[model samples]
Target: MAPEYLLWAAVLYVGAAVGSFLNVVIHRVPLGESVVKPRSRCPACRTTIAWYDNIPVLSWLALRGKCRGCGTGISGRYPFIEFITALIALVLFARLGLSIAFGVQFAFSCALIVVAYIDLDHQIIPDKISLPGIVLGLLAAIPGGMPAMTDAVLGVLLGGGLLLTVAWVYERSTGREGMGGGDVKLLAMIGAFLGWQGVLLTLLLGSLLGSAIGLVLMASQGADRKLAIPFGPFLSLGALVTLFWGHAIVRWYISYAGLAEI
Candidate 1:
């Protein structure tokens, strides 16, 4: 096997391990539980999960997605998240190679996974992740990171402020809240990492994706916009897309529009 393949495999293994920890974060953060302590256990039987049984995707397959202690069914999402996280890491590695950029973006990606899942299950994005993320994003820029320091700062302000203004306008017009604070902060954190341009692209992508999904759900279920679909997952996905393909996307849009690339 090529040395490059060996390195890629190592990254995949590390990414899956990190994803396993992310599972704990997603499950515990929203519930106000400590993710660090109280070693992983079977929720059904309260048996501590041994290290061998906790091997990311393989253990779940070996156990057939069941708790070995009590034979209780485990959600497939566990292995799914691990696999997806590994894939995302591999993609980032391929794109950015082994550098500070990869480290920053990978951490940001992991946080997004945590935020996305938590929002999906609980309709909330925890400040515990976003607030610190904002700071971290800003710091990441110091090391020749994405978009430079100035862009990152602007991303924070514009990202948070743009959504905040829309939310305010929406609430005033409808006499009801249309957006959550969590979404705003999540975008802000995205801006911190991707910069103001990223914020715009992420918003456009997220809105388009969310709107399409919303229309489908409403049509199929005979529900309305009041159905309360969580937006964090869409936004997280958009951010990931932007991180990976933002520059190419920008160039394409410019060329397609017959505008000179800036």
Candidate 2:
């Protein structure tokens, strides 16, 4: 009801719209297709979606999640992505207010959303997203940016290098690739925005959370240890958690370890 809440709601709505566009990029970029050349169409029938059907979450609900012409079943992922993007935008707005930091965080969040789903479905992270993201993030780290340029560069190196080294060692020892290039790039992209401390935080948090989930999955009857689980989602989760709670988490750890002056 308040003006601030209304502004946040509007931001979320815009974010949802952006998510719809991102869906196109996520689906096309990995396949070596131009995301801009063709407008959105139904995969089932190649019918160009009408403007009415393309209105983010509302259209999906209105159409009952089916193509109007071919009556094809639409994946719920469409609305789900929109909804998640909206939620993330609202949260970021609340945390950062209306500022450049909010814009940077919003862009980073959208990238993560796309990367998370693409990696989950295809087991690949497109360099198209990560490589450009690194450059953009560093450019954003001008004198007035969220982090200094020095921090941005260090973050990129630390995030990518640490993962790359571990991946190499794991592969050499086990004769299996324990990490993918995509994962390395994703971390590097995240580091560009959050800096080196964020990279370390993301790694520690992601590993702990991922290991727990893996343990739970292994205990389940239908799960196999050999089954590959995409790391992008966990990395995204870690980056998000770090974005909101990194300072507090670091302070808590230091105090718990008696390493901080009280």
Candidate 3:
């Protein structure tokens, strides 16, 4: 293989390793556990995982998806997360090459991966992730950076403000908390990374995709209007889509509307 391909392969491997660590964070952070204090261990047997057994996807396959000490079935999510992280890293590398853009995109992808799973499982997005993410995103938006600072600031305001307003109105109208504070923070994080344009795109695309999923779930008797669906995952998806294809999507929409390009 070419030298560049080899380098990317190494990067992907590292990303997979990071994904394994991220799994620990995702699982423990929400439970108010220290992700750093404890080394990797099998949840079933509470046995410290040997270095070999901790290899990202390979270890899962080698162990036949079971704990070595107790033969308990391991969660498939471990390997799945590793695979997704590797794939995302490869994609970002291909798109942005070896640059700051690559780092920002990779960081965003990793955050989304953690947010997606955590929200799915617990319906919560920890301040540890979202709050730090907001600050990091803004820092990433420094002038001449991946996203301009102006854009980042606008995104932060638009994303957080819009969600906060909607949540407030919904609560007032219904006399209930309709949206979680976590959702607002998550969007703010997205805006910090993607900017105001991205914030708008994320909200638009997220709503469309979320609505479709809700409709499908309702039709299948899986969910209903009364059922609470975590909005963080859908917002993450929208942000990811915007990160990669925002410009093209915006152009296509404008052209379809018979408007001149800005």
Report, for all candidates in order, the number of backbone clashes.
0, 0, 0
Task: Give the least accurate 10-residue stretch of model 3, judged by summed lDDT.
Answer: 221-230
The 0-to-1 C-alpha lDDT of every candidate, in the order given, reads 0.94, 0.89, 0.90
Candidate 2: tens digits of C-alpha lDDT, residues 52-136 = 8899999999999999989999999989988888888888888888888888888988888888888888989989889999998
- TM for every model, in the order presented, reads 0.95, 0.90, 0.93
Per-residue accuracy of model 3 over 69-180 as CA lDDT, tens digit each = 9999999999999998888888888888889888887998899889988999999988888899999999887878867899999888899999999999999999999799
TM-score for candidate 1, please give it.
0.95
lDDT of 1 by residue, 142-191 (tens): 85667799999999999999999999999999999888999999999999
Off by over 4 Å in 3: 260-262
Candidate 1: stretches off by over 4 Å: 260-262
Which candidate number would show the highest TM-score if scored against the true structure? 1
lDDT of 3 at 171: 91
